[model samples]
Target: MYVGQGGLIMTEVVGMVFIIIGIPFFLSGTIGLLRLPDIYTRLHALTKADNVGLGFVILGLAIQATSWLEVAKLFLIWFLVLVASATSCHLVADAALRRNIKPWTKE
Candidate 1:
């Protein structure tokens, strides 16, 4: 029930679809973070998987944005978060490695 444009209905539907798709990625990331054996694996789950989840969420929101500028800004925010997450993950993994933290193995 949007106010201005009738097109808003389609936009809202698409946004909701994207958000629904993202939920499972977030769920799996959370499960992996909790169930994984070690810091490295947990970081992988949180950084890689969760970033994708957030990306989908962001994309969904972006699709509902009123203007091209808003869409660009949303994607820019996603990119910044992605870069920061990857950098932090690498730094943390490096620190763990330097401190002699071993990775988990199934064996």
Candidate 2:
């Protein structure tokens, strides 16, 4: 039960829904990171799924924000996370390539 904070029940519920939706994406990404055979595949899974997950979570948080500024800040945080993850993933893949790490094969 929402107490105080103007009791915005609808927004709160919607925000929780978004958060719940995002959890699975995060979980799947983590599972992929652990189960994938190669660095490239793991990186692919981590960045793609986790980014989407974070986006959904951020959207949910933004929906529940009390003010425009809070929403903007949330968006900014998501953007920064997106940039950081992408840059780190690229760097890691490049390093792996430089080290001659081969991709996993079925055989």
* Leading candidate by lDDT: 2
After superposition, candidate 1 runs with Cα above 4 Å error: 2-6
* lDDT of predicted model 2: 0.94
TM-score of each: 0.90, 0.90
Residue-by-residue lDDT tens digits, candidate 2, 20-104: 9999999999999999999999999999999999999999999989999999999999999999999999999999999999989
- Extract clashing residue pairs from model 1: none
CA lDDT of 23 in candidate 1? 90
Q: Any runs in candidate 2 off by more than 4 Å, and if so which?
A: 2-7
Residue pairs with clashing backbones, model 2? none
Clashes of each: 0, 0
| 58-97 per-residue lDDT for model 1 (tens digits) | 9999988889999999999999999999999999999999
